[model samples]
Target: MVDTRIPHLPNEILYEIAGYVDDEDILNLRLSAKVFEYITNDRFATTFFGDRAYELSPEGLEALVKITEHSVFAPHIRTVVIGHGGKHSSAKYHDLLDQAFRNLAAHGNAISIGL
Candidate 1:
C-alpha cells in the first residue's frame, strides 16, 4: 500500500530520507509508490553485480544483460561494478564482460574496462 504521508512531504525531505539508505533499498522504495519513484530519481540507483561477477552462471549473465538494457531501470543505473573472482577462465569472464559492455554501450552508457 502506498503511504499517503510520504507523498505529502516536501521533496527535499523525501530525498534526504532516501540518501540514508543503500541503492537497493532506494530501488525497492521507488517501486513501492509513485511518490518514492519520483524522489528516488534525484539520485538514481547503483546496480552492483555483487562479488560473484566472474562466477555468474549463464542465467545470471542473461539477467544482467536484461537489466542493463531495460529502458526504465537502465537510465536510473548510475554504477555497475562487475568484478572478477578468479574462479573462472579469463576467456569466459572476458566474453561475459564484453557482452555486458556492448549492452550498456548500446543503451548509451560509456564504460571503461581494465584488465
Candidate 2:
C-alpha cells in the first residue's frame, strides 16, 4: 500500500532526480507522466544532459538535434564520438560511428564531424 505519511514529491525533487541521470533515463521517465516531462525540462533540470549522450531515445535525439544545430552549440561540437563502452571498440564501433555520422549528416546542421 502507498504510504500517506510520505509527502508527495515536489517538482524540485523530481527535477533533481531527472537532472542527475543521463538522457536515456530522462527519456524513459518523461514517458511516465506530464509532470515528469515538465521536471526534466525545467530550467534547472536541463543542465544535466551530458555532452555526448548515446543509447538515446528518438525524443532525446530530436531535442538534441534542435539544440546543437543552433549557434549556441554549433561551434562547440567539432567531433562526434561513437563507440561502444570498453571492449567493443573495433570494426563494429566503426560501423556504428559511420551510422551515427550518416544520421548526423542527414540532419546536416551538426557543422563538424569528429570520430
Candidate 3:
C-alpha cells in the first residue's frame, strides 16, 4: 500500500529532483499533484523535442502543435528536435516537419533543425 504520511520534502531538494527527468517523464510527473506540477513546471517547462519530430504525419502535426500550444507547455519549451529519418524516400515528411517547425517557432522557443 502507498504510504499516506510521508515526511515533507525540503524545498531545495524537490526543485533539484525535477531537473533530471526527460521531457515525457516531466509531463507525467506534472499531472501527479499540484506541488509537483508547480516545481516541475517552473524548472523543466522546456523539452528538446528529440527524435519525436519524425514520429508525426500531417494530422499528427496538427495534434502535436495543438498539444504543445497549451498554456502549461508553450513557454516552458526552450529547445526542440527537428530531424527527419533518412530512410524516408519521399519529401512529404520533411515538408510536414518544416511546417511544424514554423508553428513551433511562432511560440518563441529555440528551434534546432536538422536534428
Candidate 4:
C-alpha cells in the first residue's frame, strides 16, 4: 500500500508541490501543516516582506517596528510603503513616525520607501 499522506512526503517533494501553487494557496498550505510551514519559511518571508504597505497610524507603525526587529523577515524586506491618509497634526503621530524610521534605519534592509 502506498502511503500518500502529505507529511509522509519528503521536503524536496513538498517544496516542489508548493512551487506550483499561488500565494494564497501557499498560505493555506502553511496553515494546514507544520512541515509545509517549515519548508516554505524562506519563500513566505521573501514573498510577503519583499514589499509592504502600512498606514501612518500608531498601530501600523508599531507593526512595522515588529517586522523590522524580526530576524527572519527583516532581511527579506526590500520596500516599505507609508500611506499617510492625510496630514497628521498630532505630536504623538510624529513621534511614532520618527521612531519607526529610526527602527527602519537600524534594520537597513528596506531600500525603498513609497509615500
Q: Indicate which candidate wins on TM-score.
A: 4
Ranking by TM-score: 4, 1, 3, 2
Residue pairs with backbone overlap in model 1: none
**Count of clashing residue pairs in every prediction:** 0, 2, 3, 0
Best by lDDT: 4
RMSD to truth, every model: 5.3, 9.8, 6.1, 2.7
Weakest 10 consecutive residues of candidate 2 by summed lDDT: 42-51
Please give the TM-score that candidate 3 achieves against the real structure: 0.46
Candidate 3 — what's its lDDT? 0.57
Of 2 and 4, the candidate ranking higher by TM-score: 4
Ten contiguous residues minimizing lDDT sum, candidate 4: 87-96
Q: Please give, for residues 7-69, the per-residue lDDT of candidate 2 as tens digits.
A: 357756676677677765766777777777666564323344223554333443445555455
Off by over 4 Å in 2: 1-8, 42-115
Residues 1-115, model 3: lDDT tens digits: 6544312566576676666767668877777666777787644544533223434445655655664566666555544444335544436666655655566677675644344
lDDT of each: 0.61, 0.49, 0.57, 0.80
Residue 64, model 1, lDDT: 65
Across 7-114, the per-residue lDDT of candidate 1 in tens digits comes to: 787888887877787875777877877988877664553444311132355665666677776665554444555444555455665576577767777767654433
By TM-score, the better pick of 3 and 4 is 4
Clashes of 1: 0
